[model samples]
Target: MSAWHRPSSRRDLFRFAASAAACAALPGLARANQRPEAFTSGEIVENGHRFFGSISRGLAEGLEQANKKWGRPNAYILGQEAGGAFVGGLRYGEGKMFTRNAGQKPVFWQGPSIGLDAGADGDRTMMLVYNLPDVEAIYRRYAGVNGSAYLVGGLGFTALNNEEVVVMPVRAGLGARLGLALSYLKFTPDSTWNPF
Candidate 1:
């Protein structure tokens, strides 16, 4: 056998430990204060939108409407007031870690799992439709009302800023899949364009 390798010195070991701790704290710190005060409508229209594997603004708009039907407490483009619209999108960074596809793996198999996805933007853009009604419908349609929904996780319908809505991410992983199904539900004021 060869001579055992040392970590250079105690100082080096401490440095590694410090670095690991710093890295572990980074994600939680980044997600903190992610909530925004307002977003604009023009930004949604100008920016490219994709939905359910389709690149159609109409569908996205429709989804927004559905979210509203269920009482989307906050809705707007990227720069408008954050309330009124049910669906809201925020800037997201690539390499961000989120539980997206964890259930598929055999090792710990937690059902649809979470993962770190890499893409544009230093922070990942989060699009949340604050509507519980639509979410319930989605669960019924996709996985049947009587039976439990697919492995996609639930945000546990909760109240945010006096509004009942579900949080959803735009990424194409499991979170987005469940959100996509939720988008198919109908919305109130049904104008198709800034109905609220």
Candidate 2:
């Protein structure tokens, strides 16, 4: 062989393959860091119906109606929560947060409430998040208003707002529910029993 020519070996092939793989992954990594664009109401409605089945019809309609006022959401969370209340209430849930341009991230949320509330209810919830600048923006305590009636069919919905981000929680479940309460949800990176 000449000085400028060398036979390619298995080691060289492996190195080339590894380099190509890393290069291909760079775009995905970069995209993961970027904020996602707003998603359509139809997309969220479809997902809700698919996940919750027959009961989701009311929730979908509620979201569609709210979409007229809130516009499209930048992200959404699909999760289930079960909790009971006797004056003071506590709830916990886990789900995946989907962004339009970026991928999904696992999320856990827990919260406490106090007011004229009493119930033992378990519900599947789809939360539409609006004006979210980034995924990390969701990791905060969102304050809930006392008497924002967002109900449809057998399902009920509530709107929780904290400045620019608006979270509309659509729920389908059972139990004697009444009155309103001051509540807040804390979205954490991991599941925790602590509600504070």
Candidate 3:
């Protein structure tokens, strides 16, 4: 009883109250800074069409082709653009990338092509992205092969590959075009006119 002690002074009680308040606030601070977990499949499917619009029959068929040819994708990008070619061609577009973990991020892509390709066209594109470790993995160059383009009912799609990541770009547009060209798309943080 002689050795027993408690917070008997006003200063000691104030110190104890301050320490308890800080400990209670720690969890909320940690939660606020943490990144959210991956998105669910339903959320991805719902938002896919929300950004890209209702899929057309041709586009659906094209997606099936991509799924059968390439594997299922973990993410997708929705964009729109216009371009044409004579001997050399350039295309530029703005879009958003959606993944399982990250909700969405703005993306810009541009590229140059050479071949018999010609004609101006404007189209909305949905790129099915595979093997994406994260959203940042999309900011890089993806190369397209010559003579790999496929068209169906006013819609066209082509597959671009960069290491483990594969992007299947599906487009629905209004134009007349014919040619085969090798191209590489550079995804950047913002839009740029420089095609390199």
Residues 64-166 of candidate 3 have per-residue lDDT tens digits of 6666665567778888877777768998998887655556779999999998776667778778887776667788999985332334325677888899888
- The positional error of residue 16 in candidate 1, measured at the CA in angstroms, is 34
Q: What's the residue-level lDDT of 66 in candidate 1?
A: 42
Models sorted by TM-score, best on top: 2, 3, 1
TM-scores, all candidates, are: 0.25, 0.80, 0.71
What does the lDDT read for residue 170 in candidate 2? 78
User: Candidate 2's C-alpha lDDT?
Assistant: 0.79
Q: For candidate 3, what is the lDDT? A: 0.73
Better of 1 and 3 by TM-score: 3
lDDT of 1 by residue, 85-136 (tens): 1132222112211111111111100011122221211111233434323212
Candidates sorted by lDDT, best first: 2, 3, 1
Q: Per-residue lDDT for 73-167 in model 2, tens only?
A: 88999988876677788878888898978878888988888887776677787888988877888888888953322222247777888898888
For all candidates in order, the CA lDDT equals 0.28, 0.79, 0.73
Model 1, runs deviating above 4 Å: 1-35, 50-54, 70-126, 129-165, 169-196
lDDT of 3 at 8: 88
Q: What is the lDDT for 65 in model 2?
A: 79
Candidate 1 vs. true structure, TM-score: 0.25
